[model samples]
Structure formats: structure tokens, C-alpha cells
Target: MTETPIHPWNTPQSTSSSASTGLTPEALEAWVNARLDLHHQALNRVLAETDSRTPGNTLRPYDDAIFELAASSSLIGLLNSVHPDKAVRDAAQAQAQKISQVVVELALNRPVYDALSAIDAAAADPATRHYLDRTLLQYRLAGVDKDEPTRARLKELQDKATLLALTFSRNVQEGGNTVTIDNPSELDGLPPDFLNAHQPAPDGKITLTTDFPDYLPVMTFARSHNLRRRMFLAYNTRAFPQNKQVLVDLLAIRKEIANLLGFSNWANLATADQMMESAANMQAFLDELDSASRDGAEKEYARLLSFSGQSQIDACSRGFWLEQFRRSAFDFDSQSVRPYFPYDRVQQGVLATAARLFQVEFHPAPDASTWHPDVAAFDVFDHGTHSGRFYLDMHPREGKDKWFSAHPLIPGIADHPSGTRIPEAALICNFPGGKPGDPGLMQHSDVVTFFHEFGHLMHALLGGRQRWAGISGIATEGDFVEVPSQMLEEFFRDPALLATFAHHYETGEPIPAELVHKMNRAAAFGRADGVRTQLYYTTCSLKTHTEDPAALDLDQLFHSLYTRFLPYQWIEGNRMYAAFTHLVGYSSNYYTYMYDKVIALDFFAQFSRSNLLDDPIAMKYRRTVLEPGGSLPGKDIVYHFLGRSQSTNAFANWMNEQFQPPSTI
Candidate 1:
């Protein structure tokens, strides 16, 4: 039988007036309290009805009810931010945590595991069996196999880790040093609006914040060496005062939790659901990449250093000089590309690419309620059939969530008793907004980011499977999840694809072919240095997570790791780990970026050989990989898609291609 389809937003019946209000803080708190009370009672009722041997059971209904309850609880937490009452907001967070804890408990129970296993074993159909298997894997990953005491401890550790992660991110977002520059010459190569945004002080200095929109331009383009160095240091040194200790404590807790769960290290525990699967493999992969790229990187660094002249090139000046050297050599910079990548046009380009690759249509939905005013929504149609709805929260705001791509609402089996088609999803991003008179254009990097995130958005929305929310889009192995998005990044560089959307914002002229070629050539210039830096982060994460927490001196450990792996010496008191949001979000799975890139390159190779827009290849990709989600093991999906065993050699080849020195003009 085909699995049931359900609307993504269908909610359980709630008689207590569905959380609307003109209520004061106290009344709002009371309303939240009442709802929590009802949910608590309902949960107890469901738990009582669910046991190891319940006959011809009510378990399915019970599970569905619990899922709705959990989703509603999470929604309340999200919506509470918009509440006028602080008390109501606090109450919603507390209540949501409580509900989440309970749901986690139920879902991680042995009985649930046994039931899922039974379903997997007994299901006659492949699809249903795959669904059950995926569900079972999620439970197992959540520590369902642990003894009661261990499970309880794991839950506590996870909860604490979640809260700590949030605190770490919040600290980074709120904390930063601001600088003011008097001379406009210091801001040379910056876009005009960036300069305008910062009001000049009565004394004539223009203020700058560490926000990416402000900082990146200065770092990339500023002519003032001292100013660029200062800004770069400040930007890199966020969360030092507050989050340093937090990182240490969080790392300790994670290590302890991993030990209790029978893993040798936190990396092992975290990577269980990822493609890499262990710290050793990740280390090996990094080591291989480092070995392969070290010569190329050193050569690139030497070329950059030579451009600065021996007398001026010191440790302090190297970074600033290197930036200048790159611009001089490439003759193409981010600012040069921005005019060709206007925000609205890029969105259309992204949608157009999707239309060709996946046979989907996108239409603007300007009326949708969004978290921020700048956010835009769209209705996504499958071959002219309405399939899903998505909102792009593109701009940043005070107290808004930070950078990351997410499906706040994932498409899945709808909760309707009479199954309805499951509408797909929404994607949120924190891209920058442009000021008046200038269209908000993106850099090529930003264009690739749009494509990458949309790749994820499409993965969530287009998967035609029913019944298994576990196997939906990004719900797959963390390491493997990035493959689809990474593959999409290649499209940004494709001339055919770029021709579709890349045009001058004001004049509507196509980006010159010569410019495109230059851009592509320049793309590989700093690749080795870039890849090496990423490897440092990935390696440091693995070391911190795998080591015995009590033995680690967080500062010294990070410093030592950087000194050993990175090309440069470690700076004292540089607490980069403190601001590493990925450590919290991705934890020990940080190596997933490289892991997925390997597969992504392989996938892109296939598209390069075949026509990128070939309908048959696209369908095959959708059927074998995208649609299957977590319904198959990552290895199985990859093998099936490639028709062969996976290899890391492709990653090495891609890196080689990237690190190849630019031919002399």
C-alpha cells in the first residue's frame, strides 16, 4: 500500500482556544500554563495505553498524537518570541522544554524501538520496510539502546548541550568590537552603500561593526593595512570573554556523555549517523587532504608573500598584504561580481535552475507573514501543480536567529485521518539587505550560498515519499546531507547556468564571457589556503571532542592543535573555538563538510559528463538519492546513485584541481 499523505501544518484539535491573545503578561502566562497542563495529561494517557505487549495496538494513533503535540510545543516556543509579554515568552520556553523532554523520553524508549524493529521485520513492502528501518535508526541514534540510567543521563547531557549551544551562538551574535575610521580612503574598494550606512561622527570617523555586511568589505577591500588587520583580529576574536569557558565546559560534558554511551570519544558518538562514521576516518581524510595540498598551499603563500616585497612582509603584515596580492593577481574581485548578481534576479535564476533540473515552478507570495519585514515567500509548484510553500527570511534583524539554513517546517505525512498530499517546506536565511538606490546584489559566494541552501530546500520539498518523516530531506546522515547542496554549487560556475540569471542589475546586460572566465580562473587561486583553514577547524573539533575532557586545557589544546596543523603560528588568547557555532550545531560532525564535498564532486562529475540539464539524469537523481532520503543507508544511496562503491579519491582530485597554480598572464 502507498503510504499516507498529510498536510504539513495540520494540528491536533485543541479546545483551549489555540494560543491567540489580547491577554496581558499574567493572562498569557496562565493560558500557556493551562495548555501545558492539558498536554501533560494527554501524554500520561498515551503512555499508559502504550506498553511492551499492547494488543493490535493503539500505538500508531498514540505516536501520531505525540508527534503533533511535540510539533505544537515547538511552534509555541517559536511564536513566543513575537509575544508582547516577556512572562509569556519565558513560560512558552519552559513549557516547550518540558514537552520536548517528555517526547524525547517516549521516542527513545525500548518499547518504541521494539515496535519499530517489529514493523521493519514484518513489513512486506520495500517502502514501508525502509520507513520503519529509518525510524528505528533515529531512535538508536538517540540512545534508545542504552540502559535506563544511561538513557536518562544521555537525555540530561543532550538538553544541557542544546541550551549551551544556544548560549554560545547568542554570545557571538551580541558581542563584538566596533571601530570608527575617519578617512574614506581607508574604505577604498568598498561598495558605496556600505560607507553610507555608517554615519560619520562629529569628529569625522565612520563607525563600523563586526557584522559580516560591514566587516567583510573592509577585510577584503580596505587599502589601510593597519585598519584591515585590526578589523580582522577583532572579527576573529568574538566570544573570547564569555564563550571561552562555555566551550570548555560544553566539550567536557560532551566527552563524558560519549563515554557513558560506549563510544571512545564524542566524535565517534556524533558521527554514528554521518557518512564518515568515526573520528579516525575523518582524521585520515583530513591528513590526506593536508598532505596533498601542503606543497600547493606553500607555493601559493610564497607567491603572495613575494608580492608584498621582502622588507614589508612580516608576520603582522602578511595577512593584509596577501589580500592586496590576490586582488592584483586575479584582477577580479567580489565587488566586480556584485553588480551582476542582483538579489531578485538571483532568486529568479535559482528558481529557473530548479525548474529545469527538477521540473518545478516558483511564484512570489508577497502576502505571507514572515518573522522579518524583508522576508519574502513563494509558492512552489511541481510541473505547474502546487506542491509546497516556502518563505525566504533573507535579511537579518535584532534578536532574529543567526546564519544557517533550515526548514522550520518540514514536509511529511499529514496528520489528516483521510490522508491529504503533504505540502513541502520553507527555508530561512540571514542574508544582508541593501540600502535605497542600490539593489541588494550578492557576491558570487552569496550566489553559490543561495543555490546551496535551495538545494536543501528542494530536497525537503520534492521528496515524494509518504509516511516517513525520518527520511525526509535533511533528516539523512549529516555528512551525506551536504552532498546535494554542494553539487548545486557547481551550477553557479556553469556558463550555461550563469547565462540564465547573471546580468547587470541596471542595464540587464549579460555578464561578459571573459569576466566569467576570469572569475572561474580566480576561484582556484586561494583554494589550498581556504581548504587548509577549514581542515584546521575540522581537526580541532575532532581533537577536542575525542580527548578526555578533564585532561584538556581548552586554550592550550586549541593553540597546540592550530600550531601543529595550520600554516601559521597560533596567537595567544585567540579563542576561535568560543565563536565556532558549528561545534555546538554540528558538534563532532564538523568534518561532514569535507566528507560531503567528496561525494558532491563525484556527483557533479557525472553531471559534467552528461548534460547538466538532462531530464533522465535529473529523474535518476531524484528517484535514487533525493527522494529516498534516509530510507536507505547513506552508503547504499550513494552506491546506487553512482552504480559503484564510494571513494575519497574524487575529493583529492578536486583539491588538486583547485590548488593548481594560476598560469602566468
Candidate 2:
């Protein structure tokens, strides 16, 4: 394999910017508050130091100080989301709003923007130029070009928006509702282990919570439609009523901000500088994908309907029937394969796969302690030397984000006197962790999710090499950001890789080759409903964000979108958007998941051969695609790596194949 270039911005590092271990609740507030103070001081110093290039410009000091503050803030933020102690979490959460407020204030400061803009950056290093350009874009996006009063209003709006988003997230975390199943008969088709592990209510009935472990299996396996419907409603209705007004206020504020920013709508404003550039472009992209997938999706739906032997379908019962159909057709039972994928074995496989392909090693970071016992630390070594570190906070509890993701905690920087700044990241997920004395086991789909989140973590750990903290580590455009995670799906699908670590937790036996083959063949069985379901989310998001929020009913919009795009009958009284946490973080960009899958597939075509774990291709991919982050345009990076422009042909074919006859594939 050819050696990849060690960019000056992210050379292999040996030091962590975090204290990492033993931060108590009492100290947490002081530590985080002090960091915020330092951040404000650094911003003021940067504004005070520079005016023009007639004299020498020296904002590097400002850059260093700000990044140091960012690193600390990231650690604090990570804790707030997943820390075991409620008090420490409370302090971090309190400090977070303050940090975001300060960040926006400094970023939008006219004097600061002017000072940075005045520097002669044309002749500077690429990273320096990247820093200058990115900073200016952020300032402009924050409304730095507005008049003083307008800017002040925008500042207030910005702070309110930040607080509102935080509020939206917190409501979901603390307010999610749970259900108790007082009837054992309601657990039909559920695994024996599930039944054995979850104790019945005091009245001798099984209890089910809306957590993924409880909710997903019932949706996908339980034969009782009434039970499934109850679970679905309870899960979908979480954070509702409370989040309903929150959404209304948030959408109105976003609209106001967009109008103030000289855009027609919030979607346009949000996508202004992203790869899509406007909501219209994103809509066009969605329209094209939907059109291409419609025929295949229709065929798949017909097959499902026929096999289901039911007159109609709904969100709750589709997965149950689909799994039934899959078993009858492909002779595969997904649940039966679970024992071969204990959570520990799956984690090993994921890390081992990365180690072989990317030439990185992961070792226990006993010193890099975290707030939660569930969170495990790993020191990352590249080329036999310590380069960076990241934490894995697998399994969920109350107050944690429901979805799976890798959050960047610190950016990797080179040539610092404190040794090369090591990148840090955290993987937050909710998989099935059985109660004490029972092993945590994962389904195949959960394994895929693990691989997907690992992609983001790897992107952060390896590609975080940037001189500027603002544009480091998976900071690619929103429309293309899902590519890395989606591309990792290709590896998980390879049966050869699956067999490498898949062994029965009790029997110590390898998964049978026949089972692997059956699973792979049925992998794309749900593509139609998956794609159609995404369309509802993406289209609803765009319309909700761009249209007049006051004139629309959140529930009505959700029902209409579902009825239009999905074959399933919409359930009345369900407020999906109210409980949709993505609406806060992803907002108008939910479509990117489908949009980037096209690009991800196109990228995956480069490694069509059998061995996905090959080192050379992996190294090339790391250098050309991962390391640069968003410093270069996504289009440029795609061309550099593939030697051609990206197109949607690959994704179209992949979607179509699912509906075709088995022999056709």
C-alpha cells in the first residue's frame, strides 16, 4: 500500500486535550464555567489584536486559545448528554446553553469578523486559508453583515433558538412515556429470552417500554396487531403535547431567522452554503430518487401485500408481516441468528474490522474515564504509536439521545507545543443490554447500526487532522455527511466478515454458512417500505420548515404525508413530528440520509471485489475522502477519490434489485 500524506494540520498525535478522568459534579460546574470564561476572553483578545494587514497579523494565538476552549467544552457537552450522575449532567446542561450563547456572540461579532476578514490570507497555507474562509462563512451565516440593531435581534434569536433546541431535546429525554403489558398473551412471537429476562408486572403481566429493545421486537415479531398498534402509538407519541408547542415556536422562530437572513424560508436559509444550496435543490434530488424507486417500491409492496394475506397494512403490522414473508420465502429467521451476535462479540468484530482495514489499533484506555460506567474508553494507535482516543457509550438509559451517532469531542491538530492535539469522539447508541447476569446480545440490524456509527467515529479519529477546530472531522456538507456511515453498511453485509466473529454465545459455535447466505439474500427485502418511509419524513420536514407554520397542523401534515407516500393506513391521533427528535438536530436535512446513500453506493463501487478488508483501498479512502473533512468541496473530494463525478445510477440499480425476481439478481 502506498503511504498516505501526513497533512501538517493533523499529524499523528500523542496527547489528549481532556482531563478525561475523575471529574466530579462539584468540580464539573467550575471546570466548564472556567472554560466558557476563557473562551470569551480569547474572543475579545482576537477582536482587540487585529485591524488590518498594514501591520503584521497574529490571530494564531486567538485560534489556539479558542480551540483549547472548544476541546474542554466538547468534553463537558459529552458528559451532559450521557453522564451517569444527574447533578453533573445538570451542571453540564446549564453550561451548554451558556457556551452556545457565547459561541454565537463571538462568531457574530462585527469587530471579530472584521479583524479576521482583514488578514491577507491569499498567500497563507491551505489550512490557514481554509480557516479564514470558513470563519467568514460562519460570520455571514450568523448575520454579521446586518445592521447593528438587526444583528442584535439576530443574536437574541440565535440564543433563543439554541435554548429552544436544547429544550426540545430535553423533553424527549426526560418525558418519553413507557407502557406496562399486564398480559403475557400479548408477548406472542417474542423470544423466550425476552420473556425470561423482563419480569412481569406485580400483577403477573409483562411490561414493555418504548425503548428500542421493547418497541422494535414487538413491531417486527409480535403477531398481535392490537399489541403492536399500542406499542407503536406509545413510542411515536413520546414527548408529544409538550413538544407540539415546542415545534410550533421553534418553526416560527426559524422562519423569522430565515426572513431576517434574506432567505425565502428556513430550509433555504439552512441549506444556503451546504452542498444542496437550497431547499429546491434538495426537493429535486428527492423527487428524482422517489421517481426512480417508485416502480420497484410498488412491486415490493404488492409482493408484501400478497404474502401477508391481509387486506391492508399499517405502520405497526408491516414489519411483522414482512418478517413472516421473509421467513417463508428466504428460510431465514433473524431472531434465531441473535445468539451468534452477542454485543461483546459484535463490538470486537467491528473494531477488528477497522483495525485490519484502516491500520489502526484500539486498546483499553483505563485512564480515560468517563461519567458513566457503560461508557468504555479506547486509545487509538496508528502505525504502532498513539494517535488519538475515543469513547464508546453503548446502550442507553434515561436522559440520553435515542438515536445512534458519533459526536466529535476534540479536533486533531498538528505542531502544537502541548504535543499534537489528539482527536476525541464518543459513540452514543441504544442496543439491547440484558439485565445483570445476562449477556447483551445484538440482532443483525443492530450490528449494522454499530458498524454505521463506527464509520463516524473512525472518520473523526482518523480524518480529524485539521489546524482549525471549526472545520475538522466529518465536517462535510449536510447532504453528503451520511456517506461515510452508509458506506460502512457494505462491510457489514459481507458474509465473509460476519463469519469472522459471529459465534454462539453459549455453544461457541460459528454461524452456519447457510444462515449467512439466507440473511444476505433477504437483506434488501424492506427497501421499499424503508425508502417510502424516508420520503414521508423528508417531505414532511421540508414542507413543515418552508411553509407557514401557523397555517399548518403538525399532526395533519404528518398524516397527509404518510397517506401520500406510504402504502400503510395512517393512524389518527398520532403526533409523530411532535416526538421527532431529528426535527431539532437535523431539521430540514433529514433527506440527506437518502441523498447521501446514492453517493455512498457510488463510492462503494470502487471496492466491488470480495475482500472489503483490504488495506490499500481503505488507506486510499481514508486519505482522499476522510482526512480532508469539509475543507474541500464534497464534489472535489468525490472526483479526487473516484477520478470521475458522482451520479445516481448505482443507487437506482440497488433499489431496483430488491423488487426483482431472485434469479435476476
Candidate 3:
């Protein structure tokens, strides 16, 4: 039986829809089947084309299939992470797995590849030609040209890889462990509201889960070393023991797949299509970052260690000591700025800043139906023409995924037979303050994170209006994807920008420039250490895929890498890899964050600091950097905007900015 189509964005802006009233499990299954049928039909049409291959007869149908499948897969995939109901989430996971399998099978489909190969894209427009070339390259990479038996095996391995990835992520989402405080006094040094909200239960004990809201504050502000240690263990070891084997098996499968594909290792295979080019290149980049940050990291750690009077700062105690050091050295208390960054106001500021910078307007879709009441939907208009829609699911809850990200739910295609398909995206985050009377006083870092994710949302929406769905939105190379997000983070440091939105929750007084200055100075001190930490993760991700999985000791590798890049004494039970969800999606390329940081900083430096929001450069950046999406190669995008190759000089200068004398007002 067929169900009524409920395309994700089909819900009107004025209607309130919850998970209970939204698509049920049965409806989701039927919807998936319907979409898959359309996908198959489109591909079949490509194969059935009797005339010479043109963009319309062949590539158009192929792109249509991709666009349709993405809509089903992306929306259902998001349900697995954010849908409040477990049953819906589980069904979504199953459907997503099924969609993934179909994708793998299509990638290996010989007939479609042959048909696409026949197309003379030389006669087509530049974007269409690029689309064809990229598609052909991807097909070769997917082993569509392999012998029949090899193709079969590759498909099987890829399907298993998909399942393993799902399993690993599900474990992390559902595997949130908790720490219990035996004495309420252990909560001392935490924010007053945090202490109030976490009052002892009837047994006079407080329980904290590994969710970000609970874990971050405890790690940063708690005075009790034992409490911080316990919280760190709980947070780090999430999905441990279980995901350990899962990861090992997944890596082994990836290694085998790489071998079959004639690649040296999974790292080499994964990066082949990206800007990094090769694993050796990735290593060289990481080494440069390591060398650049080494001395500064050492000095920063020594300063923190001396300030704490502890012989060695445990990994768990790093945030605690750093906070104290910032207060003592830079005269900044992170908590002192929290009053000005209530979640709602920070949200307004992010929207306003983006609007002013990008020349867009955001209107609240108050009556829009979302999976949860906490989610806020907004429709975006550029120069008064409706552009796209975005959702803000910005709080934590039981059974929700713990990480923050922007999920593109619907791929926007500019030219479709039915109509122009406008894009839709959501920010799935775990920021504080969604409860009644809980202002969700965000740390300045949280405000930065909000800007970071919104950057992705903007990318998805603005870049979405392309002729082809495959190239629409954040479809750029995997390595280039983080530039927009991280670049937006730099804007959060602007005092004038912060003054526009950061106001005390009760008093409504804007944050003082002096406080903003101190906050930024304190935040800058950790840049080198942050870079080192990223290197540790980047190295771990690279090594895991490059090294043999059968004999690899994950614990030994993790601990060794930590010691190599960080000065913190490693705790015995830290299994951060288990909960490192990036491993599932990013695979062996966690270096993406650091690599893109270099580009992001270079891009940020192009804007005039004094007129950041109103700078003509902002609009130029939107057109040259963000608007192109994946239609152009990343290097081309960078060149068009910055007129040169991206430089690490900007990042290096940023790393040392904390040591530079403060600029006079």
C-alpha cells in the first residue's frame, strides 16, 4: 500500500508537527520504497536512452535519481539522530542502511556507468561537464569498472562497512555513561545555576551523564579533581569495549576493500578524491602543524602546570587548570561572560550577524512542525525572494545524539519538472538552556560553536540553488567542507559583532568591549595546545587506517599519540576513540578540521576587521567562496576569493597571537 508523500519540506510554515504526528514507522518505510522506486526508474531511464547521450536524456535522469534518493536518505538519516521517539529513530536507521546499500549497488552498477560513459560532456556546459567528469571518476573509484566478481565483493564489503558505521555511531549515541557524586560539595566551583539544577537526589548523590551540557561544565569549572577525573573517564569511555571491536572490524573491512581496489591503504583510498591528494601529503601537513605548535604547546602547558602547582596535569584536568590559568593570567572568567550569552540571544546574534554579512533575512517559522518543540524553524529570504529554510534543534535530551552538526535534509535543485526544489537544513546541537527558567547561559565557546554550525547551514542553503543536485550545497571535496564552519568561528571573536547580540539575560546590558577583549585573549592562549590536540586526533585517524588493523593495539596507539602531541599525563581509562563519532563519517581523514583551519584563517584575514559585517568583502566571499558550493574545485574557490593559494601563515600568526602584545583600542 502507498502512503501519502510527506516530503520533509512539504510541511507548511504555519503548522505544528511533532514526532507523534509526523511520519510513523510504517509511513517512513512506504516513503522510502516510493523514493527508491523513483530512483530506480530514473536510472533505468538513463539505461533506456536510445538516442545519443545528452545532459537532458542521460545525465539529467541520473542526477534526478541522486536528488530523490538523497531527500529520503538525508531526512530518514537525520531522524536516527534527532527524532525523539526510539521506534522512529530505529526505523530511520534501518531505512538509512537500506538507502546506503542501494547507493553502493548503484555505484557498482555497470550498465549505468556504461551509459554515462557514452555521454560526450565536451559539448555540455561547464558545470554539467564537471558533473559528468566527477561522476565518472567516482565510478572508477567505486570499482564499477572491475570484473563482475570483484564488483560483487566490493559491494558486499561496502554494505558491511555501512552497517558497521551505523552500529558504531548508534553505540556512541545510546552509550552515554554517567558519573555519580557521593558528596554535593564535589560540585563546588561549578556555575551556581548548574549546582542548583543538579541538586542531590534523595540519596544525597548527584548523577551526571556524559552529555555535553553535563560533561563540559564539569571538566572546565569543577574544583574537585576526583570529580573531574570520574567525569572524564565516563565521557571518554562512552561505547567503549563494545565499539572497540566494532571499530577493529570496520577497519579490517576497509583495509581489505582498499587492497582489492589496488590502493596501498584505506587512508590513500579515502583521500584520493579530496584536496589532500594522498596520505603522504596529509602526513606532511600534520607534521608541519606539529612542528609549528610544539614549542608553544610546551610553554602553554608549563605555564598551566606551574599555575596549578601539580607535577603533571592529567588529561582530565587540562580544562580545569586552563580555566583557572585564564582567570589568573588574562583576568578573564569564562563564567563572567555567560550571563551575556543566553542561548536565545546568542541564536538571535548568530542569525543577525549572518544576515548582515551575507545580505539575507531570517523570519521565524513559529508554527512549523518539527520533531521536537525545542526546534526552531526559520525561512531565509535574500533581497526579499524566498531562498531556503533551516531548523535549529539546539538542545540535549535523553536518547539524542551528543555531537553538534548541521544536517542538510533536502538537496535543492534549481531546475526540476515539478518546480524549483528549495533546500532545507538543520543544526543538530547540544547547547545549554532549553528548559523553563534555564537561560542556557552559553559559554563564549558555545556561541562560537553556534556560529560554526550556522555557517554550514548557510552553505547548504545558499549553495543549493544549482542546476544539478549532486553538485549542490556542501558537495565540495570532503576536506574543503569544514572551511565555512570554521571560518564563521573567527567572526565570534569580533567585539563589535558580540556587542550586537550578547546581552545580560535579565539586565539586557550589552557585553562590555573590555570583557570581550579579555575573553578573546584568554581564549587565544590555548591555540597551540588546541592545534596539538588536533594533531593527536589527526595522527590517530591516519595511523588507524594506514596501519594493519589485525595486530594494532588501539589503546597503545591512542596513549602513545596523546603523549607525543600533548603534555597532559594520560589517564589509564581514557577511550576517547570509542566515542569519536568522526571516525565513522570522516573515516581516516580527521585531518580535515586542521587542514581546513589553515584555509579558514586565510579566508578570514581577507575581511576588513573594522567593518566586518558591512564589508563588501563579505558579499564577495559569499559569491566566490560559499555560493559556488561544489560546482568549482576547492582550489578554484579559494583562488577566486583570496586571489592566491591558501597560506598557513594566517594560522601560524593566530597560534602566536596570544603571545603578541594586545592591540590598543
Candidate 4:
């Protein structure tokens, strides 16, 4: 297999202006906005043309034109943080979002899809025909097959869903716990940095927020079990006041859209393009997992209950007890590891890992125009030619969208390969900020998260033969897109890989082998609970999608369905479903995580049974899976990589082993 060219979207380029080369954020934004407007107008004119059925040969030009418009507009939105004026940034973002919505609508309209189909049928070249067919399928799956009225309704639903998701995330971000700790002794065992970050009022009461930096340390290390319970409840109940209604409406809208598109339910509609093609198949998979795991989860839960000093298990006690047990039993804790995994070191570790695995290079690029000081940019290069550049932004700030993702601003397309180097692609996360006494340190889990998101960055940066924006890296099957990232998480546990980066912040000592051993052994400690939680989410999502919107009690139904796995006497107001972002973002496709995990675990098995840092194996994986983009089916990619059908049995066995107590006990 030929090595793909390093596209500008994947590598970082300098945004700074020099006397030799003229480029400024202000100038770039203005030029981009003008270009976007021109392209938008051109697309509108073409779409409005009396000759809607353009010939196949002519479609490439039209498609290229439309893609350029969307790409430019979206990139401007992403880069708008450079705009000094808040109003300018807001206005640009709104316009860009509007253009994006319109582009989606155009792609999903029947006439546009018919035109693409005609193009596909008439194209003489095999590659051209394949591209057109793939494009046509995407449009159809996006709901282009619907009639005019339904299409209009679908657009409305899409817009509403977008706004609702944004709203829900905002509420969660702003909502945090305001703890009034009367005794400083309650803070015993908590990290000093965490305590320093939050200050007490005149009455001598310290406050805590639901933010991961604040909440995670408290939950993991605080001596007070009652405080941990309070924090857990607060974190879990985010956006509850309004999110319940938002979820209900969102579910109803999705169900209606799915029904209109000829699917039995939203799950079927959502999973059509995924490895698991139907809700029935997903449920069967989950059921098989439950059957395999029922005894294990119960045993773990009983052990946890006993550890918590509780005679009876209850809903609120599970999280608090789990953390306590994990710390006490394993002599391994997130707090103990956090000091060793500084944020900057973690970032370096991830980049270094990617470089070794994929033969790519990353170097920091200074740009004062970034949204925040925490946001850093990097340039990526291919080892062979050293010719391509892409940018990385790795921090969360106010007004920016909340989540972790690799957003490709410039999508690689066949026709527009060298037109405009999409200057930036980014991985955004909400990690803790640096402080005076302590530079921001991340837990081992956070280190894994850093690696996971960079897997997405690599996927986005490594542009394939195809260049269309819509069918780029993560634009593939929602179910399948996670495979690359999930596969990367395996690297976190690799001692060979950790030897390169994992170090103590104060003394710069390497993470101890004994700790690594305990970590590996305790790795499966809460595997059953994690899997069960995921299953509950998948079940709740399917139930919401498959049911009648008007007839359903959304909250009540979700609680009832998910609690089936819960032991009797646990309260119904677990309200976790209310806070499930996947129910909105993934819609009926929460099963993707499970589906992707099967593939990911299978992929991991290839390396786990061999050297984790085996370059040849990693290269084969990149070639077969990461480099394909959406040019081929995900199953084909998996089959090519693994040389067998994807199976969940190994995943089940892994979960069971994790839940099993140490033989020493």
C-alpha cells in the first residue's frame, strides 16, 4: 500500500505574519468570508437552476464547488476565535452554522440526490462512478429519499436537535455542586492542588463544582463518603431541570423522522450504515453480553456493597463505594498517578506515540490568535517527504463547543487536493487548567483520553484518496468511526510506550513497574459495571427510538427499562438517561460504542498477543482501517484487518475477568 500524502488539514502551518510572507488572522478571516459568500451564492444559483438533472461528467465541478463553499464556511467558523470582537465571532459562527445546515439540507433533498444518481449511472470512469455512488448513498441515508414536505420537516428537526444539544451541554457545563464543607477534616486524603483550586467562604465552607478536575479528585480521594455521594449525585443530575423535556422532544422528533424514512424506528434508521444494521441485532448483542456478564456484575456489586459498609445496596451508594473499594483494595489510585502525568507531558506522550506508530512528526506552532492561552497548535509531517502540515488545538474555553473530537476544517477531496491547504484540524478537551503551585496534571485515565482523541486527529490528518468534506475521517459510520480511537487506548497500558513519557512531575522519575502491574491487574476491577452502564445507555437509546413519542412517558420509560439490570430496591430517579448526551448526539445509535468495542477489542487482540509497540502491526492497521476513510464499508475494513468476523466473546471474557476478585483474596 502506498503511503498517503500529508494534507494541510493534518499538518500544522504557521498562522503568524512575516515581512517575507503576508498572512494575518484578520486578513485570512476576511478573505475566507468573502470566498464563502461567493461559493454559497454560486451553489444557490446552481441548485435553483431549471436543469436540476446535471450530467455525470459535469457533477464533479458542481460537487467540488459546493464542497469548497461548505469547507471554507466551516473552517471560518472554527478559526473565528481569531476575531477580536465577540460580536464578529458570534456573527461568523451563526452564519457558518446556517450554511452548514443548508448544505446538509441540500445533500438530503431528493432532487439533489437524483441528480447525483444520474451522475453515478452516466460516469464512464470506475473511480468517478464509485465516488458518485458513495455520495448518493450518503445523501439517501441522510434522508434525501423523503418527499419535499418531509424533507422540510427533517430540516426543522435537524436544526432543533442541534440547538437542543447545544443547550443541554451549556446547562451541564454551568451547573455544578456548591458544597458547604463544615470540617476541613472531611477534605483529608484529597489532593492539595484540588483543595487549593477551591476556596472556602468566610464561614469556613469550601465549595466544589461538577467539573471533572474538581469532582474527580473529590470522589476518588476524599475521606468523607457522604461528601462523595453528594458530589456524585450533583454530577449525575446535570441538566435535569430542562434536559428531560429536551430529550423527550428530541426523541419524538427522531422517531418521526425515522418513521417518515420507512424505518420501523430511529435505531434502525440510525444503524443502517453501521456494522450492526438493525436494532434487533444490537439488542441480541447486548442480550448475549448481559447473559455472559449477569453473574459477574452481581458479584462485583455485592463485593462493592460489602466494601462500602452497607447492609443494603442503594442507588446513591454505588459510585461512592466503587471509588473507596478501588483505592483500598488495589493500593492503586488515580490521585497517586496524577502527579506523574502532567498535561503537557501527556500531550507530548500522545504525539510521540502517534509519530512512532504512523511515521508522522508533530512540532508546536506558536499562534497568539488562538482562542485561549491553553490552546496550542502543532505541525504534522510525513517521514518520507516531510511535505505536509496540519494544526492541533487542545484546550476548552468559554463559547467553544464542549466535547472531545477531531474536527477536520479542510476535508481532503479528490478534485480539490491541492487547492487550499486546510490549515488546521484540532483535538479539543476540557482538562484542568494550570495553577501557580501545580502545573495541570492529569490522571492515567486522562492520559488514555488524550491518546484516544489524538487517534481521531491521526484519522483526520491522514487524508485518503477521497477529498469530499462529507465523507472524511469521522464522517464514516458513527458506529465504526470510534474503532481507531478505541484501538489507541491500548497504548496507554503499554509499558514500552509509557517508558517514553510517563514521569513524575517533581522528580521526573518514571512510573514504577509495580504500580503498572497493579494497574494492569486492577484494570478489570469495574469492567462489569462499566459494561453494564453502557448496556443501560444502549437499551435506553433503543427504547426511546423504537417507541411511540406521543404515547411514551420518556423519563419513566427510560428509568424502568434501564433499571431492569439494577437489583431490586434501587430507586427509579436515577435520571442518568436524562443526562445522556448520546441519546441526542448519537440519537438511536448508542449501540455504536458496543459495536465499535467489538472491533476495537478484536484489533487490540492482534497486538496484545504480540508486541504492543510492533511497528509492522501498527502500520498494517493504519493502512487497512485508518487510511480507508469512508471510501469502503467498515465491515470490509474490519475483515481485512482481523481476517475474521468481528466477535464480542473476547470482550465478554475480558469484562468477566476484571470483575473476578484477585486469587490472593
Candidate-wise lDDT, in order: 0.66, 0.78, 0.89, 0.66
Per-residue alpha-carbon lDDT of model 3 for 54-75, expressed as tens digits?
8888998999899887888888
Q: Among these predicted structures, which one has the highest lDDT?
A: 3
Window of ten residues with lowest summed lDDT in model 2: 5-14
TM-score of candidate 1 to 2 decimals: 0.86
Candidate 4 residue 327 C-alpha distance from true site, Å: 3.2
Tens digits of lDDT, candidate 4, 5-46: 222122123233331123343444455555555555655554
Question: Whole-model lDDT, candidate 1?
Answer: 0.66
Cα-lDDT of candidate 4? 0.66
Better of 3 and 4 by TM-score: 3
Better of 3 and 4 by lDDT: 3
Off by over 4 Å in 1: 1-59, 62-96, 117-120, 137-147, 310-323, 414-417, 421-424, 569-571, 609-611, 658-665
lDDT of 3: 0.89
Residue-by-residue lDDT tens digits, candidate 1, 250-348: 988888777886788888888776667778878888888889778877877778767766533432344455556656787866567788898778888
Report the lDDT of model 4 for residue 69: 59
For each candidate, give its TM-score against the true structure: 0.86, 0.93, 0.97, 0.86
Predictions: Cα RMSD each = 4.9, 5.2, 2.0, 5.4
Model 4 clashes, total count: 11
